[model samples]
Target: MPVTPGGKASDGTRADAGALAGVEECEEAPDVSLEALGSVATTTDASPGTVVPGSPAGTPAGPVSGTSPDREAAGTGSGRDTPVERLEDPGNSATERGTGRPGVAEKTLEQALPSVLADGPPKVLAELARAPQRSRAVRRDGLRRMGIATGLVALLAVVFCAVQVLRPLPGPALVMTGAPSYTIAGAPLTPAWPGEGEAAVEVEGVGSLGAYGDQKPIPTGSMAKVMTAYVVLQDHPLKNGDDGPVIAVDAQTAKESTAPGESTAVVAEGQRFTERQMLQLMLIPSGNNIARLLSRWDAGSDAAFLGRMSGAARQLGMNDTTYTDPSGLDAGTRSTAVDQIRLARAAMQDPTFSAVVAMPRVTIAGVGQIDNNNTDLVDPGVIGIKTGSTSAAGGNLMWAAQQTVGGSKQLILGVVMAQHSAGASDYGLAKALAVSQKLINQVRKALTCTTVVHRGEVVGYLDDGVGGRAPVVAGADLTVIGWPGQSTQLTLSAPVTGLPHRAKAGTTVGTIALRTGQAAGTEVPVVLQHDMTTPGLSQRIARLR
Candidate 1:
């Protein structure tokens, strides 16, 4: 009996026909099994001559036909080989069946590559571990260099700050230079007279109150003629008895002074007189020709004399004053009240200047001289200053007086310039006198020596020494104010009364004024005005009774 390739009986062979034969054939098929077909397969081949278990082939080299389980499986099934499972025991353990080779399952990329890379160390750490080591000495040197650089930077910052703090920028330095603050005791030192004019109060040491108006510039009229006289007296001294000095009136002076529509002393042409008489005519009569004659004599011409006037004014600190002509007739001659007061203060200091200006009359030596017509200065206490008039400058006047208080004599100067009205010249003069008198009284009341003395044998000897039952006169007519108190110091602003200059009878002799205190305060007249000469004893005693 033959078996088919599919492990079935052959076509001509019967199942019973080959029962014994088929059994032999089946036993032989195990030796020719498909397990022997694959190359390099580890399974053992069971072919011819192989042994079988429980078979008549003697060694049992081959499986028995129909009795061996493997032979039965190969014979009954189709020819394809099936997988083999080894049996360890009757009830086999499945774990014992695996081969020594790992049964590795198939892996996706997601699980394999990522797991490998993640488990490895980073490349940078690996490289650093292989780098060279720095020595301890090199590390110390680097730290020291860093510390030095930091300290140098900090030192530079401190040096810059010190330089900025110590240095000073250049500019102007701080300093101060001026007069100490002082107050004049009186009513706010008003323009003593009205409407911005110049006044010349007679003063000693400084000269007539010419500097008063010098503060402001304005045209001066007849008053400038007085300045012309002032300049002449600066050079020549006029004695009271020396009436023979020759004063030739030049032709030019005669023509210019007596020109049509000009103010004149009416000196005849070519007339000659003493210097003393010319000064008297110039001042007492307000003579224009006399001013011209004297100017020419002193400085060679009126124009030259005016030059000296300017120089004198500048020397006296009259910065605002200017003189275009000798007589103030030319509206160009001008000054302020402040400058005029200065000039007057200067004039009162000079005995000769005071005498010439105060005289009411003079006797000419050679030909013609005139009596003074300035009635304003006739009063003994009313010292002659100067007067001026013009169409533009108007009427102006300045005067001064002296009075005694507490046995001390003082002088008060006043001025009125540029009173612009017709027939107002005397009005300014009267106003000046009235204001000055008031000032004198205010100062006297404030003085420390305001002692009241009744009419008696002698209250005290006057500077003039005209003694008798000296009439008790009010220092200044206390019209504006009744009285002033103590704590006010009255000093003689100028000098003692009866100062040897030609003065009027019953003229104000001195000005009594209070001292300026810590703050600006008031000043008034303290002593009484008196005549230069006193009356007889009978008249004084009558007044006393």
Candidate 2:
């Protein structure tokens, strides 16, 4: 065999018509020694197999003419047909490897490649070059599969993104809240309850304040007269300043008017009086006979009229009330301060009833004038309501007063019952008026003015159908009367047609109703604070992993 030092044949020619293209080749004629070819395969850079490129994937697959019978390897992974010849090493002898086989360590491509080619047939040279090309083709197929897999992964990512972008989202978080004060707080002082009786108070549009001790049913006395008047007005409704239908005084009522020890308005049998005048006589002077006379005139008899009063009580929401007679003179007619307050609230809403009760005096034909028994009506803030007194029921008064709060007249209704004195008959009514007047004055003073909510404050937010939101703000300051330490609650009205999405700055969405549990609430307009546009991914929907 003759081989070139440059990894090519000595002839500088291929072994046959077919040969390796780029790699150095060797041509052999017969049996050859590998010693001359050992140094030919090594370079100064090739000190070990680490720097060596792998041999042309070992020998070609089938048998060849040049290989001897002893040359085949036994199950060796290298794929070489023959046992490798050893390269010279300074530390070991040539046959140091067991079985005298070649060792891969310290071997370089420059040292090993030429010897195999030099002693082999022309097909081995062609196979050396062809084996590498075959390996390169396998790698090219693997790279093509990897590229297609990469493209599929990229396509899946794109599909996931498109689905997320088109998906629908729930509306934004919309809630209304007021600015809570951390330090600006104080509880309202309790109402001054009467020393010895049942009492309660209620502001118009506000709920009941509270009922004090022994609120169970008690005699209503002349307070029953108020209910009589309420029933009378209900049957024969009258507008203010109008004299209603006239009624002739009956013989029985005229006779009772002259009774020595009974309450009555002066009257003559067969004499006619208008309905308004009759009620004035019954309510203002507390004419007991007039009360009975009106009851008989409305219903066929007194018993039937009592049934109407009881029915009226139920209709007015007076659950703890009972009526046994047309007049409160019967102790069997029982009521609670809570029940009377309910009736008083409904009665005051009528103009004819309220006006008649507030009158100081009314002129008549025979009797020059009759003064109202409810003298407290003359007080500045005090208005028309009724008073009742009896030996059994003590003194009870149902009263209404007015005060200017936030430039609007606020009506207050109250009831004080069972004010009694063992010493004198007059003490009961006097004590009731005195106690109620004091409570009214205290309430008038305690009605403090404050700004509950400020304009442009973020009381809540309006949500879009997507995940976007805009601030729902108060459009104007809410300056109104409210008690100290009162907590305010807010509620939203349905948003205007297009909200959060099409909202503009200062556009009214709805009104926020503010309640303090103290008095009538004030309503403030809710508006958007800033203009809105499109929402982002995070705002429109939950974040995608």
Candidate number achieving the greatest TM-score relative to the actual structure: 2
Per-residue accuracy of model 1 over 132-207 as CA lDDT, tens digit each: 2334567888999999999999999778656544443222111111122223233332223333454443322212
Worst 10 residues of 2 by lDDT: 44-53
TM-score of each: 0.44, 0.69
The pairs that clash in candidate 2 are 41-110, 41-111, 42-110, 42-111
Full-model lDDT for every candidate: 0.49, 0.69
Candidate 1, residue 247: the lDDT equals 70
lDDT, candidate 2, 1-545, per-residue tens: 34343332457642231233222344322222233234344432211111112234222222123444432331222454432333445354434333465553344233445444444445334544455566689999999999999999999977876776677544444566654331115675478999887999877763446778688999988889888888888999998578789999889988888876446788888988889888988988888889999998888799999999999999988989999877688889899998898898888888999888878788977656999777788887888688888888888888988888777877888999999877875539888888899888877766655666788788887767555668788899866554454445556565554444565788887777656444447777888888866667654344432
Superposed by TM-score, candidate 1 places the C-alpha of residue 230 at a distance from the truth, in angstroms, of 2.5
Cα displacement (Å) at residue 279, model 2: 1.6
Cα lDDT over the full model 2: 0.69
* Alpha-carbon lDDT of model 1: 0.49
